[model samples]
Target chain A: MSWLLALPFFIPITTALIAFLARGRKHLCSVISITGCFAALCVSIAIVTLVVSGGPQAAQMGDWQAPYGITLIADRLSAVMLLISAIVGLCVALFAISDINENRVKLGFHCFFQLLLAGVSGSFVTGDLFNLYVWFEVMLIASFALLVLGGEKIQLDGGIKYVALNLVSTLLMLTSIGLLYGLTGTLNMAQLHISLAEVDNPVAISTLAVIFICAFGIKAAIFPLFFWLPASYHVPPVAVTAVFAGLLTKVGVYALIRTFTLIFPNDLGFTQNILLGAALLTMLTGVLGAAAQYEFRKILSFHIISQIGFLILGLALNSPLALAGTVFYMIHNIVAKTNLFLISGTAQRLAGSYELNEIGGLYKASPLLSTFFFIAAFSLAGFPPLSGFWAKLLLVKASLDQTAYFVTAVALITGALTLFSMSKIWAEAFWKPHPQGHCKSLYSLSVAERLQRLLPVSLLASITLILGFMPEPFIEYALGTAGELLHPDDYLEAVLTGSSH
Target chain B: MNSIILQTATRVLVALILVFSVYMLLRGHNYPGGGFIAGLIAASAFALFAMAWGMEAAQSALRIPPGNLAVSGVALAGLSGLMAIFYGDGPFSGQWLTLIGAKEEDGIVISNVLFFDIGVYLTVLGAVLTLIFALEEAS
Candidate 1:
């Protein structure tokens, strides 16, 4: 059973080694990468089924007891997270086969790609806080390598800012973890939950909670700490940016949700209010920043920050429904956002540039590409009958149920602003005539090349459509995860008593 | 590329460092000297070798690219954990076996835990050397 949890990360780490070893053999590397991702996907599905049917599962490394040895736990949240990550990972790996050129692969792009997947999978399943930190570093290091893989001057500049800010946040997280350990005398999250309750000093715990907020806040790219995101995210290739945009900040958001719900539930008054204020600001500022951008990818990058605000809003509400809404929104946004980036990549290939002013006529050149852009872009903007609409509706309803009128208004306004920026992209990149009156067409590409590029884009877009049309099961799952999170007794018992199944 | 004295010292130092690194790796299970430090020591020996001789000598000495070495290290370290799974234990659970003919009074033991340590030793050494060699050769 524990092996099921380990396989998600283990498959990727091992595949990375094999892929790197077979560096010059593109066919071999692709085979290894694809097979690894497929295995991880299968394992994730199995683990999710077990969690949904049985309950949370845990396994101590080296057979060590709880609160002593490193542990891996797969509760509802972790299982769902792993399932989504594997899905995106496999898709991106397939996409990269055609999207990434020969020179980049020779620079170990496939290796780092798998390593990043390993890190994300590890982050989801880890049962200890320090182990979580280790996973963050794993993800961070791989991301840094991926970000600057091309060694272009602009990428290096972006990479420096990305690393510098994240390093500061990492140090801050470490400091808080150290303090939390001193306070509770344990690094295991379940143990910390119990130990934190036993502590008498609310002031000290509150201070430590603030440190955690600052740390994860920066990583999550909430307002005032989001400068690094827009600066760095657009510099990487579309495939790299797609994965980072989809997973990286979400890890920060995941940590925030996990910590606030499990460890610091005692002082919602102090933390929730702070989060509410930040959430509103993040939404407004992120959308406004997007409105100011002309590059297709740049606009999408700012949207990542704004969408994070909606997710954070659900966390601040801290109600069961609100948390469930956040979970649903997270799933919806990841697929939709990643598809948008992937579509932008194909569009860029046809349009001959990412700059909106220099490129146009895509709608006439390739209506197929235009349709993909429409579905993804509008879905991101919360258009009705699409995935984003449902995600936004849940959040709006959650806010209304709590009578947080201010938050409700902010969310709606942000959605409107998002639509505006997305429409701006549509008008510039797709709807309008080319500034030069001519643009390359996707139809010009070979059949195999076209399929390789559009396969992942269509796959992800279909998922968004499925999540929209058939949202009942996903909603039920999210609510169940919310219930488990709000009441963590099952997770605690699973780890403390060893896995029951 | 290097002074005669420096080249002479590198040869002896490299051999001594490699031997000491093995000692540290073996003792790491119960002591402070572990795979990480031992790997660093081994990498430093090669780094010193690279400095004394040219990049070509270091390349010939390694006999494989540092990138490939790091890849193998990661694979070895990860596979070591699978030993427990075959033994019907949890992932990464330690599996031990006593030598078949050894007497109890011999005071020596062997385990899969040591395999994991060796994997770590290789990973750190390979990864560090990869980074240093890339920068050195590029410059």
Candidate 2:
């Protein structure tokens, strides 16, 4: 049973090895990757169940214990995150098999895709801060490769900026690990949790906290630090871009929550204020950035920045309820965001362009796509009855409870802006007529192309709806996970106690 | 492809990076550096040699693409974390051994974490070098 915890990271990696050695068989490589995704998903779920039934599991490499040995811990928070990452990774992998062209496949797309998943899953499950940084690099390296899969002028240009910025983040994070180790004596997350609380110089601790925030914040694509994402995310194949939209930056957000909640809980006073204000600005900037865009994928990329603010508000509030909302929002955002990207790709397939000016009257072209698009759009905009609604409801209620009037107002306003931005996409890309000139140039798809295109995305779309309707189980788990985070004594005990045991 | 002296130096430096990377990983637990810094240090060594020699010559000489080095490094590093599952330590627990004898009596038997560090070392060295090589070749 304990062997299952290793599967999520191991399966893809092994399959990746096999895929790489398949001697240029592109079809076999893709099939191997998709199979790895499903296996990882099942293992992720089993690990969560194991954590729930048998209690938290800690493993020390080579029989060497912690403080002396590097450790991996699968606590409630990490197991739940592993599950979420597996879902997103699996859905995107399946979607990519169909949406990715054969030309792109020859570009080592499967290799990059598998590496990205490995990096992401490693980040979710690792217990050491240093290991997490390596995982970050893993993901970033793969992302850079994927973003420029075709090596086009725009991709290379945009990928350069993305790579440089991320490299800086990695350098900063590595330095912070040095700082934390120099200051406190451990890179183990639980040990750091215990050690950081004992450090007396309030100022030094606060400075370290800010450094961590900057390091992770860049990855999350928060405001004032998010320009690189929209610049580069739009350059990749639609499937690759869509998955990055769903997963990459969210890892940053996850790091923020993990660090703030676990490593620096005692020093949240000034940092939380800064993060709170940044959240509002991020929300506005993202939606506004979306509004200013005429390209379909670019608009969604901008919105990613804005929606992250909602997730951050939960962490900034620093309460159980707010944390739960943050968790819920992260889940809802992944599903809805992936859905939008996939559907938008479908729109591109049928309509022939991502430029809104060139793509109009989606309602006239295909009713089914518009319906699915509407579901994802409304859910993203925080409309009631969907999962997005409940997440926002939790966040809003938490804000009001804390009497954070500024954020409360900002949340409602952001909701409006979100709705407005999504509608612009629907109207311009779906409702409005593709002016006579553009319509004449539309690309027609073969019947098989259409079916191959719709099946995987539709499966994901249905998952989004089902989760939205039955969010109770998920919500309860989120509340529990958030609770464990706020009260991380259990996590501390899991690591520290295991070392002594 | 030009001169024997320069080619010899590149080979020496690449070997040096590999050794230096290991030293850093083992020294990390108690000192200023650890697996990550050591890994990068080693990688940088390879990168410097790659810069000195052409990327193609380096890739072929290594007998495999550096990209695979990066990929395998990540997998090995992750497997290092999963090492704890076999023991009862939970997920990513630290496994350190303090070996006694020879010149350094208090020397620790480097655990698989060093292997993890080497993994990172290769990945960093390979990934950045591959990228730089690709960009350079493209131009």
Candidate 3:
């Protein structure tokens, strides 16, 4: 059971080593990376199955008991996150084969990519706060490398802003961890949950909660702290940006959810209002920012911020339904967002530019590619019978049930604005005549390059469609996860009492 | 750096520091000296060597790319943890074996922990050297 829990992260690290060793041979390295991601996906699926059948599972490292050594626990939430992230990792790896150049491959792109996956998986499964911090640093270092892999002037410029702001967040996190440990004398999350409840100092606890909000808020790019995201996300190769878009900020949201629900569930009155305001503002600012962008990836990057607002909105509502909404929305956003970035990459390939004014005629050149774009873009914009629609429906319903009419209004307005941005991209890039008078079609790409690019996009789009069509099981699973989160007795027992269900 | 006196002193100091690093690694399980500290000490010795004899001479002496060495070290560390699985324990559970003497208490007892430490040692050494070498070459 422990091996099953550990394999999702362990496989990626091992793959990273092999891929690094094989970096000189590009084909072998890519093959190793793709296989590694597939193996991780398979392991995560197994974990999800185990967690569903048996309940939460926990494993202690080095044979040490929990609250003493590192524990890896997989509840329904962790299992689902691991599964989705692994899927994203595999898709990005496949896309990278054609998207990445030879120079970057030799520079160990596959190594860092696998390491990032390992960090993300480790973050999802870790049952310790310090362990989560370690995983965050692992993720940060790998992402920084990936962000500036080519050392383009633009990449370097963006990487610095990304790193500089993130480092501040890291510092705040460390300080908060230190304060929490000094107050509670434990870094183990389950143990902290118990110990913190006994601490009578509400003021200090509230202060610590605010600190956590600021730290994680920066990472989540909520409202005022989101400038770094749009500045940096559009600078990388589309494959790198695609993976970052799918998994990175979502990890921040996952952390915020984990810490707030598991560790600070009793302090909701204090954090909820703050989160609600941030969520609404984040959605408004993000959609408005997207409305102002003409660059393809830049627009997508800003939309990531807006969608984060919705995820946070679900968290702020803090009902079982709202939390379920958060989970579903996250999964939907990761798929649709990643697929959109990938489609943008393919669009750039065909139209020869990411600037809306510089490229056009994609719909006429390749109707298949245009269809793929419509599915991903419209899904992102919350069209009916699509994944984003269900995700938005859940949140809107959650807000309405809470009688939070303001949040519901903001959410609906944001969704419409998001549609406006998507249509702007469609009209300029796909519908209009090509500025250069000739647009390269998907057929222009070699058979292998075309397969390497389109397969991931199509698979992701199908996933969106499937989720749209059959959200029942997934919604039920999410509600179950929300129930477990609201009452973390099983998680506590699994970690603290050294038991696995 | 070109001084004969300094180079002679470095030659002796390098060997001594390396020996001490290994000693630190071996004694780490029961003592404060551990793989991380020992690895830093070993890396410092090489950094000194690179300073005294230049990076080329240091590279020839190491005879392996630092990047490859670092990656292999990580693999070794991970494999050491996975070793517990063969014994039907958890992923990182320590597996012990008595290498010599009559009993586990009296003999030279070793465990997967030592291998894990050694892996950390190699990883830190290789990673630090890789950074230092790149910086030196760039400058």
Candidate 4:
């Protein structure tokens, strides 16, 4: 159980080394990578079990204690996050197995993908803030490689913007870490909590808070800082874009929630309201951006920015209910976003073009693919009886509890716009008639057509449906996780106390 | 660019760069000679080395992957903080034992906090190196 958290860290890296050495052995490499993913899943499950059964676990690396040696602690929230990352990772691994091979059997793709997984899984589980920064760099570097895996013209353009923006964010984050250490004389997350709990310099504290927010905001694709996301994410392959859209931005949001609730609690007055306004604007603008897009993946990319706003809104509300909502919303978004992007890939694969103007009436051509796409679309739009609806409900309820009528109204309106954008994809691709002149341009599929495409799509779509129908486990975990995050004394104690480690 | 002139010039430049980086690093304890400066200075040494030699040659001299350097640096820095556990000084506790130097916070505060600076230096060097290498390789 103690070693479970380390599994996610070690497996991807080892597989990456193996894949790197095996260069041309694509099949073997993919198999090994999938097994690594499986191990991560099993490890995550054990972590949850240990957290629930044993209450929580923290241990210092190399027998050194906290605020000193590095600690990898698993509290309720970390475990829950670990579990969700694993589940989503498993789906992505499956999708990538064929996706990477089919797209192009390049060494860079597999090597970078494994590295990317390692970064995400490690970020989700690590206890130290500095380690979190390093892990984020790991993820960012790998993602930079992944984004440009094809070395396409558009990808390079997008990659340039992505790298520049994120590099700046990392600089901000590092500078803030240094200043924070200079101010409070500590870097351990828990230690900082105790160290700065009553530091009286409001000006200094708020400045650091703003720095942290701007740094994370760029990553989370928040209101004014989000121009890079839709522009960049739209250019990658559906598989790449889906994973990026699903998991990457949320890492920023997760950092925000962790830092705000735990370390930067001194100046919630102005900070909370500004963040709240940003959240509302992020959602409204994102959906409107989605409304204007005619491309399949671009709209989904825009919604990713929008939905992230909903998640952050929960954190801004700062109540336990809102925290729970944030957690629930994040889980839903990851699965739903990934599934929708894969569907887009599958759609593009079958229909031959991504432009909805030319690629209409896919339903008539491939009913199974269309059905899967519809399920994912409905989830993205937060339709009733879908998991997205529940996540959205939690957010609305959380906002209402705080009596933030304006935010609630903005969320509700954005939900409608979300539905509208999704319906356009549904209408343009599934209902509208294909162009008679370009009929000959459509791609031909053989007997194994549905088998090749439907399995990946159906698996992801079913996971979304299952979560929607039976959200009890996820909700319970989210509640526990949110409670632990909002009141992180246990997390603080875990790192600072020798026995806690 | 014969092998002799290149090798001798590169070696001297590298030596000079390393000395400069160390100066920046240690001096940063009180002034600007902290981890960030140190890391950059060390990385600049390597960058100079790469410029004089080739990427492959310079990387070979590194004796380990840049990524490992980053991880180890982070670990070393973090290890310093965790040192408090053994002393019961609480997390990130500072131990202000006297050293050979005078009672200045600059030299040998005998604190775990100083230990973290070393970690930061290595991490910065390794991270920058990794990025430069990746970018060069990508291009």
Candidate 5:
């Protein structure tokens, strides 16, 4: 049974190995990777179903009891995250087959890709705080390789800044983990909860809490620390950047939500107010930054920062509805943002450049691609009857309930500005005539390439539509997950239980 | 710098270091020696070989690319964890088999833990050598 929890990451590890061994066989590697990801997706869905029906499940590594051994726990929050991650992982792996070139495949792209997925899955499922740190390092190393794999001048430039800043964040996280360990002699998150409460130093706790906020905040790309994201995200290939955009920062957000809710429950008045202020600035800066960018992917990268503000707002509000909103928003944002990146990649291929001024006639050439870009873009802008709209509605209502009118106002205005940015891209990239006077339409591509690229975008776009149309079940799930996050009793009980179940 | 005396000494030293690294790896289960230090020690021996005999000699000595070795190491490590599934235990759960059974703790015990340690040893050694070899070849 415990093996079930380990399979999500293990499948990726094995796939990476097989793919590495089948080095020159690109088709075989792609087949191995996609099948492995598909299998992991199935496992993730199974875990979610089990968690939803049977409550949280915890598996102790090597049959050792918790608080002494590594633990993998699957509660509603983790289960939902695992499911979304699997969906994104499978989609990205499929997209990479045709999108990535032969040179990259020969250079171990598929191996590192699987390793990155393994890291993401590991981070979501591990119940040990120290283990989470290890997973973060795994993700960092894999992503670093993916970023600079091509060894282009621009990639190296971007990789340097990305590595430098992320390393600083890693340093901060380690320091705080050390401090926490000193405060409580345990690293297990479930036991940390009890041990932290026993800590007599309120000041030390708050200080450590602030340090954690900064550490995770950097990772999440919140306001002041987000420059690295826009600088580097546009450097990688579209498939690589898509996964980075969708999952990497979200891991940071997940860490924030986990720590703020579980470890630093005290000093809310101080910590939360700081978070609230940061959220507003992050939202304002991200949208304004997006507005300034004329390149396609650059704009989307900035918007990621803006969207992170909304997820943080949910945490800042600290309401059940607000938390649920963040949960829903995370799923929505991951799909929408990834689809937009994939669209930008397709647009880059279609028009031969990522510059907004250079790329145009996409709508005239292929309405299907334009339609996808429109759905994903507008959905990101929180248009009604879309998934982002429901996400916005929940946060807005939550803010109003708390009588935080300023936050509500910022939320609405950010939505309007997000729409403006989306329209700017639409008008420039899609509606405008091509500067070169001619461009290949999507239909001009071979069927295989089109199928490889379009299939993932179409599938993800349909998910956004489905979530928008029938959000009842998803909302219920998010709400239930939020309840579990707020009250981690089930999580703690499962982790602290003596035997593996 | 390309002295015959240095090359001869390196050849002898490399063999000694390789043997000692394996001892360190095996002794790690119960003593201070472990996979990481053993791997580093092994890598240093190859580094010395590279310095003495030139890049081509070091490359041929390894016989496989360090990247391939690293991948195989990771595969071995992962498979070691999967061994526990046959025993209905968690991933990486240690399953011990005593060769001469009769009394508890009186025989040579073979376990998945040792396999895991060996995996880690190879992974570190391969990864470290890959980076150094690439840099050396480039230069």
Candidate 6:
């Protein structure tokens, strides 16, 4: 059982080792990477199935009992997140075959990529707070390497900002963890849940909660701290950007959700207002930033911030339905956002630049690519019968149910602004005639390159479509997850009462 | 660097530091020293060697790319964890072997924890050297 839980990250670490050793051989390294991601995806699916059937699963490392040793626990939330992230990881690995150049591959791109996935999976499944911090560092290092892989002037500039701010966040997170551990005498999250409830220091707990929000907020790119995201995300290779766009911030948001729900479930009166205010500002500033962007990937990067706002808003609302909305929105955003970055890469490949005004005629050169862009972009904009629409609907309904009219207004306005930005990209990048009088068609790409690039984009777009068209099962699953989160008795039981031996 | 005294002293110092590092690593599980500090000690030896002789000389002395060595160390540590699974225990559970005695506690006790520690030793040694070498070369 523990091995099953461990495989999602374990396989990736092993793959990273092999891929690094095989770095001199491009094809073999990519094959190993893809196979590793596929295996992780399979493990994730098995874990999800097991969690669904068996309630929740927990494992103690080194046979140490809970509250003492490291524990890895997976409820519905962790399992589903693991599954979705694995899918994104595999898709990005497929796309990297063509998108990454030989120089980068020789620099051990596959190894770092797998390591990044391993970190992400570890972050999702670990049941210890300090373990989460370790996973975050793993992610930080791997992502820093990926961001600055080429060491281009632009990339280095971006990487410095990214690393600088993230390090501050890390320091704050570590401090907060230390404070919490001192207060509760436990680093295990489930144990903390029980220990915290017994404590009466409301002021200290509230302070720690705010510090946590600041730490994770920086990572989630919530308003004020989001500058690093746009500055850095656009500078990486599209495959790198795509995976970062898909999984990284969501991990931050996931941490926010987990900590808020599991350890700090009460204290709503204090934390709720702060989270709500941050969420509103995050949505507004992010969309406005996107509106001002004329670059392809930059616009998408800003939207990621805006979307993170909605996820946090769900957590702030603190209803079961609202948390469910957060889950649904996260999945929707990961698929749609990743797909958009990938399509931007394809669009750049076709039209020669990522600057909006410099490229056009995508619709004329290849309607198929344009259609893919439209599906992903409009889905991001909350078009009805699309995934984003349902995700927004859930949040909107959840907000209205709570009589949070102001929150609903901000959410809807942000949705409209998001649509405006997507249409801007459409008008400038896709719908117009080429400024240079020529745009390359998809047919110009070699068949292998075409397959490598387009297949992931198409698969992600189809996932967006599936979630939009058939959201019943996913919505139900999310509701169940929210129930578990709201009442963490089962999670606590799984982690604390389960036999370590 | 051109001083013969510094180079000659480094030759003797590197060997001593390395042996001490191994000693620290071996006594780590029950004592104050462990893989991490031992690794730092060993890496400083190479750093001193690099400073005295230069990066290429240190690289040759190491006999493997630090990056590869670091990766293999991680693989070794991970594989050590997997050993517990084969013994019908959870991943990372310590498994012990008595190589020299009849009783469990009376023998020369060895455990997977030692392997795990060794793995950590190699990883830190390699990683620190990788950084130090890069910095030295860059400068």
The positional error of residue A128 in candidate 4, measured at the CA in angstroms, is 1.4
TM-score of chain A of each: 0.99, 0.96, 0.99, 0.95, 0.99, 0.99
Fnat, model by model in order, equals 0.93, 0.19, 0.89, 0.00, 0.93, 0.89
Q: What overall lDDT, based on C-alpha atoms, would model 1 receive against the true structure? A: 0.90
Per-residue lDDT for A170-281 in model 6, tens only? 9999999999999999999999989999999999999999999999999999978888899899999999999999999999999999999999987788988999999999
**Residue A249 of candidate 5: its Cα lDDT?**
97
Q: Give per-residue CA lDDT, model 5, range A164-254, as digits (tens).
A: 9999999999999999999999999989988898889989998999999999999999989898999999998999999999999999999
Computed on C-alphas against the true complex, the DockQ of each candidate is 0.83, 0.20, 0.84, 0.07, 0.88, 0.90
Which order, best to worst by lDDT?
Answer: 6, 3, 5, 1, 2, 4
Error of model 4, residue A290, in angstroms: 0.7
Sorted into a CAPRI-style docking class, model 4 comes out as incorrect
Q: List where candidate 5 sits over 4 angstroms from the true fold.
A: B103-105
Error of 3 at A476 (Å): 1.2
Best by lDDT: 6
Give model 3's TM-score versus the native structure: 0.99
Error of 6 at A159 (Å): 0.4
* Tens digits of per-residue lDDT for model 3, A1-501: 778888888999989988888889999999999999999999999999999998889988876898889999999999999999999999999999999999899999999999999999999999999999999999999999999998999999999999999999999999999999999999898998999999999999999999999999998899888889999999999999999999999999999999999988889887999999999999999999999999999999999999999999999999999999999999999999999999999999899999999999999999998998899899989999999999999999999998999899999999999999999999999999998899998888999999999999999999999999999999999999999999999999899988732
Answer with 1 or 4, whichever has the higher TM-score: 1
TM-score per model (chain B): 0.91, 0.70, 0.95, 0.81, 0.94, 0.95
Q: By summed lDDT, which 10 consecutive residues of candidate 6 chain A come out lowest?
A: A492-501
Q: Rate the local accuracy (lDDT) of all candidates.
A: 0.90, 0.80, 0.93, 0.79, 0.92, 0.94
Query: TM-scores for all candidates?
Result: 0.98, 0.85, 0.99, 0.81, 0.99, 0.99
Two-way lDDT contest, 1 vs 4, winner: 1
lDDT by residue (tens digit), candidate 1, B28-137: 99888888899999998899999999878987998987777777777777788898877888788777777765547664667788888888898898889888988987
* Candidate 2 residue lDDT tens string, A428-479: 8888898753432223666655665676667767866876898898888789
Candidate 2 accuracy as lDDT? 0.80
